[model samples]
Target: MNESAATITKPTPLLIELRGVTKIYGSGAAAMSALRGIDLHIDQGDFVAIMGPSGSGKSTCMNILGCLDTPTDGDFFFEGVEVGRMNRDKRALLRRHYLGFVFQGYNLLNRTSALENVELPLIYRGVPRAARRARAQAALAAVGLAGWENHTPGELSGGQQQRVAIARAIVTEPRVLLADEPTGNLDTARSREVMELITTFNREHDLTVLMVTHEPEMAAYAKRQVHFLDGLIVPGPNQGGDA
Candidate 1:
C-alpha cells in the first residue's frame, strides 16, 4: 500500500496498548520489578493521569509508555504496531513520528532562543530550515509567545519558560504527549497556568495526553486517572489518589 493509503487503513481508536508489561532491573534475587503485569489501553484523544507515590513504579511505566525504555517482558503496541520488540533505531523513528514529551525541568539550552529550542525536534526530523522556522513560530504563537521567540530561557519568567517548553513539545503535533511531572517545580499559580495550557491543547487539538503526576489537582484535569502501588495499578478515584 502507498503511505497515505496505508495510514488511512489503520485502526483509529486505540492509541496505545500494553499487555502483561513488566520491567526488571538487576539480576537473580536482587532484581527489582518495576511494572508487574500491566495491561492497559489508552484511546486516541483521551486524557489520562497516572498517579502514585515515590517508588510505586509509575515512573517506569511512564518511561515504557513513552518509548523511552523497553519492557523486559510482555508486549507494547502503538496504533496496532508491536513496538516492544523493535530495535532501538525503529523505536527512535516511532518516537519521532508519534510522541512528544514534556518533563519537570524546562531542559532548554541556555544559549538557544525560545524559537530555536522549539525547532530542535523539527531539525531532528529533517525538516528544512524555512519550514521548520515557520512551524516553530506558529507553535510559539499558539502558546502565546509570539513576540518572545528571540528571548532565551534566562530572560523569561519561570512560567514563560515552561510555556516555551510546552510549545516545543507540541510543535510537531505528535499523536501522543507524555508529560512527566510537568508542573512539579512551579508555584501553585504557575502550575495552574501550565495545566490550563495542557488541558486546552488536549481539548481543542484532540491530543492524546498521558501525564504522570503526584498531585491530585493536576490529575483532576484528565478524563481518566490510574493509580499505581507496589508495581501494580489499582482502581482509584478519577482524579485524586492516595499519593
Candidate 2:
C-alpha cells in the first residue's frame, strides 16, 4: 500500500478497552454499582495506573480488565476481542495467554519453593517439566531471586516473596501485566525496588502494564494515571499523560 493509503488504513489495536462498562453487585434494591459507565482505552505498551480511594471502583475496573469478572453492562474488549460475554473457561484461557497479575499480598504457596511457585502457570498450561523448570529459573533470576529458587515463601522476606510473585506473573510472557497494589505491603525502599523491576520489564519487553495504586509516588512510576471517584473516572490533567 502507498504511504497515504497505509496511513489511512492502519489500525491501532488497544490492549484493553472498556466502553460504557458498568459493574454491579447484587440485584434490585440491594445492588451496589461498583463501576458507572467507564470508558477507557489502554494502548499497547502503555504503563497506566488506576488511582482512587477505597470504593472508588478502581479494583472493580482492574477485575474487569483482568478478566476476573465481567461488566454488568456495556463491553470489555481485549486485543480487539470482546470478552464481556466469554465463558469462564474462555476467560481463563484469555488470561493465561494474554495477561498476568501481581497483587499486594504476594500470593504464593507457603510450602512451595520459589521456582515451583513460578512454574505453577506453566504447569497449568501443560508445559514440559524441563521447560517449566528452565523458564521458572529464568523468571526468578530476572526478578533478582536467582539463589532463592529453592527457598519457600516462609523462608523469604516480604520483599523476596513479592519478587517471587512478580517472577511468577511474568514467567508466562504475557502481553499485559495487571498489578493491583503491588507495593502496598512493602516499605518505601522495597516499594521503589519493586517498581524499578516492574518498570524494567515494561521497558525491556514492551509490556503493557495496568496498575492500581493509592499512593501518588507509586502512581508516578507509571507513564499515565487514571483517577476514579464515586464509581466513575475523574477527569484530570494526567488522564493520559505523564503522571
Candidate 3:
C-alpha cells in the first residue's frame, strides 16, 4: 500500500469552525481589526449565544459565519469545506441552502401579507407558488401565527412581527440559524416568549443556532455562552467554541 493511501484522514465532525480567523477592514493606518486570531468550533445541534459590548467584533464574527462577509486571514470551515475561499456566488448558494437568518429589526415588507413574507426565501429558490404557500402557511403556524397569515406587518404587534420574521427564517428548513439580537425590539415578556420559541426549535429540530445578544437573560437560554471583547473572545468558558 502507498504511504499516502495508508494515512487517510477523517474530515472534522464540526458543523462550523474558525481557525486563526482575523478580519481587517480598510488598509494601512486606516485599517480596523475586527477579529484577532479567533479560534472557535461549533458542533452539530449546538446552540451558542455570543455576548459582548458594542464594537466587540461579535457582529463581525456573525457576518462572517452567515457568509455576508469574508475574513482577511485564516480559515472558516462549514462541514469541513473552507468557506473563506468560496466565491460570492457559491457563498450565496450556501446561505440559501444551509443557513437562515433573523435580525433584531423585523425586515418585513409593510404592504406584504405575513404568508407572502414567509414565502420570500422559497421564492428565491424558485419554489412553485402552491408549494410556497403551503410551506409558508405551515411555517407561520409553527410560529403561532396560523390565523394571522393574511395580516400585513403594519397590522401585527411587535412580538407578532418578530414571530413572522422567525417564520420567514425557518420556512426554508436551514441547518444553521443565525439570529442577531432577535428579541432586542420587544418587551421583557415578549423577549422571554421569543426565547422560549427559539429554545423549542433548537430542541425539537436539533438546529444549530448561533445567536448574538448582549442580554444575559436571553443568553442564558442557550446551552453555551461565548463572550467577546476588544475583538477577541474572553478566555475561560468560551476558550473553545463548544465550551
Residue 229 miss distance in model 3 (angstroms) = 0.7
Q: How would you encode candidate 3's per-residue C-alpha lDDT over 12-107 as one tens digit per residue?
A: 147898999999999999999999988899987778999989999999999999999999999999989999878899999999988999999988
lDDT of 1 by residue, 213-235 (tens): 98999988988888998898887
Indicate which candidate wins on lDDT: 3
- What candidate 2 gets wrong by more than 4 Å, as runs, is 1-12, 237-243
Evaluate model 1: give its lDDT. 0.87
Question: What lDDT would each prediction earn against the true structure?
Answer: 0.87, 0.88, 0.88
Give the alpha carbon lDDT tens digit for every residue of 1-243 in model 2: 012321332343566788999999999999999999999998877899899889999999999899999899999887688999899999999888778899999999989999999999999888999999999999999999998999999999999999999999999988889999999999999999999999998877777799999899988899889988889988654444322
- Per-candidate alpha-carbon RMSD to the true structure: 3.7, 4.7, 6.3
Report, for all candidates in order, the number of backbone clashes.
0, 0, 0
lDDT, residue 18, model 1:
92
